[model samples]
Target: MDSRLALAAVVCAIVLCATPAALAQTVQVWTRGGRAYSLTCYTRFEVVPFYRPPNATSLVVAAASPATPPALQPTESGVSTIAAVLLVMSCIIVVVKSRSRAKFEMIIGKNSNRKENIEELLDNYGSLAPKRYKYSQLKDMTGSFSEKLGEGGYGTVYKGTLPDGNPVAVKFLHDLTSNGEEFVNEVISIRRTSHINVVTLVGFCLGASKRALIYEYMPNGSLDKFIYAENSKITLGWDKLYEIATGIARGLEYLHRGCNTRIIHFDIKPHNILLDHDFVPKIADFGLAKLCNPKESYLSMAGMRGTIGFIAPEVFSRRFGVVSTKSDVYSYGMMLLEMVGGRKNLKSSVENPSEMYFPDWIYRCLADLGSLHTFDMEYETEEIARKMAVIGLWCIQVSPNSRPTMSKVLDMFEKSADELEIPPKHCFYSAIQ
Candidate 1:
């Protein structure tokens, strides 16, 4: 009995030890008839003795569990995860780069199209097309822009010499916001003109980002310098001033009538008039010029144009009249008044508030011819001033129809002061008032 009890204790200990490896290993037991049975050990174990006949033998065999596969280390697992993240990030970067490249190409395409359109127009100009120069050539011709002659709203002018040794004024435009419209206007307008009174456009330069215009250099510079020269050495005698005014009128007449296409100089002012060594006036700065068919009497405008004091009444308000070449006549009239007065038509610094409006003072001066003596002019000079003033007043009449054509203005200039009639006092007031 004691021997049987000890064997049962040994069997229980073996079963408990093999429980962890039960899934991978097999246990075998031999019974009294020599039949082998396989048993898998579990958490709960039971040992049962076989009934042996006479001298029967009992045997138990257990095989070890196969070695379990080695588990993955922490470092190796981290490496695989990192590699997947990098691949995903690379794909995202490539997609973003492709999109950005497409956007940049679109902007470049638009600018190229605009340039092509302008070039195509120039090609159609045939023999009328002005000379074209490279941007680099401009720098060479202007001596690297060494001498700046003047500056204005559109650009700066530098004195340059052409290959033929003829002097030229090179204007380098700085305002790009106009989308090249001003540059195109100056070129096209001058190309159509071939009058001594009109400034000659020698050449032009248009590139991706640079634009410039080359013109015949006027030694005497702009008319504003001489007209506004207060107590300065630059002074034009009354006779010379009359000649300059008449030359400007002829130039305007050419623009309005002589050209195949009627051209209106929207911004006609003293500053835009250039003078040669002989002080002969030449109309310039066609940035605000408009081209229309000669048969069409009126022009359509998108917005008001010209300097404030010189803009015609009809240009700012349709109630005054339809916009037409008459608008240019009005500006010319204002410029004439400024020329005779030696000051702006509207003066804020006048001692007498009544004289603040120059046209009114000059109009009153015409009624009493002796009042003109205040200008310290001789009889002949007063005659010239009165003729110019009467003509100017007639041109500035509030109604467009009331203003004479450029042709009529030239006629008035040729007439004697006594022969001319002063415009009605009611017609001289500006619409803005």
Candidate 2:
């Protein structure tokens, strides 16, 4: 009976109190983490002091009249509002800065230090080998083009022997003059921006509208031949393809962003990539390469010089104006897709018109789950398929800004499928003359 009476009194007191905290003479708080927090209730018509309490005013009811609230509110409220505004503004500022920086950076964390931008350094540094060489010297080294090694969009590549009898690959210009200078520029610039993954430039010779770049000989030859050739697919491993793709991405990123001035390898393709003894990718053929200023892109070409299917959509005279680093991104995307599909995308079967354009096939495959059922599961083709889809999707973003940089492409290849989304296939550009 006594307990009941006390409970009733407490309930009545709680209901009648004008200020919950004032109703109770004492207050306390407890927290789960051993930290303390408190909240107080006050009357609307109180004195309202201009001070703020750190953590005070817990609600309590004791049937007493309320105390007035303070004139000033909690600093947290003001601070929170101000902080929110500032945070949003800060975020906006960061995004704008990143976009602008990317124009200069041109890609992910790579430094923009192109050698051509500092050609003076190259000229001043000078070549360890002789700058000037007689045409006869080059002819003698190449064995008078008697040893034909390979051919590419740039020109014919021949085998040569240095003074030490070390084998070298000498790329001779087929057109001479204008063509040779571009090759020289590419060789010199690439040499200046050399890394271990890059094929080293030994030296050059200029004569009678004739120029040739000398490079270390690759026993295995270009990657395209090894990966796409008949009876060669099974010889490749998932790990090896991953390495090659990653290396290519890094090389492209270096050209696009790692230099002080951005370089666009506008002529990226399998033929342009030479392979070392271990099948490592060495980017070659810089004749069509474009040098972009910090935050600025190069002018478009007078006519298309890159391989037909690999050329960027923006490069066409009709679709857009002003080709940018994103041009390379588009090409990379296509290359990745090609690598994934094997030679099926490129192998022109006269009997089958459906196989003419492979990226279109990729889009069709992506649209239907049944299309991937034909994949050869006996090999590591699945892993190759997974990476190719991801890297290709990243490269082919319609907007240059939407695409991932070469650095990002390498990072993407390194990550697992669980961390990535199934990539979307790019739309085909209307065939441009």
Q: Which candidate number maximizes lDDT?
A: 1
Cα misplacement distance, residue 372 of candidate 2 (Å): 3.7
Clashes in predicted model 1: 0
Candidate 2 residues 1-433, lDDT tens each? 3443354455345435524343222121211111111122121111223446889785554643345345443333343333333333443444445446546656433322342433444466575432445678888988787898887555678999988898998876554434333444555565676765667778776665666678889887777776676655567765677678778888888878776557777767777777888888888765333321111122225655456667676676535535777888888788777677666445567366765776666666655652354555443556567657666866776657677877777778777655777555556653641
Which residue pairs show collisions in model 1?
none
Return the lDDT, model 2, position 419. 72
TM-score of every prediction relative to native? 0.68, 0.62
Predicted candidate 1 versus true structure: per-residue lDDT over 261-294, tens digit per residue = 7888887889889999999999986633332111
Note the Cα lDDT for every prediction shown: 0.74, 0.61
Best by TM-score: 1
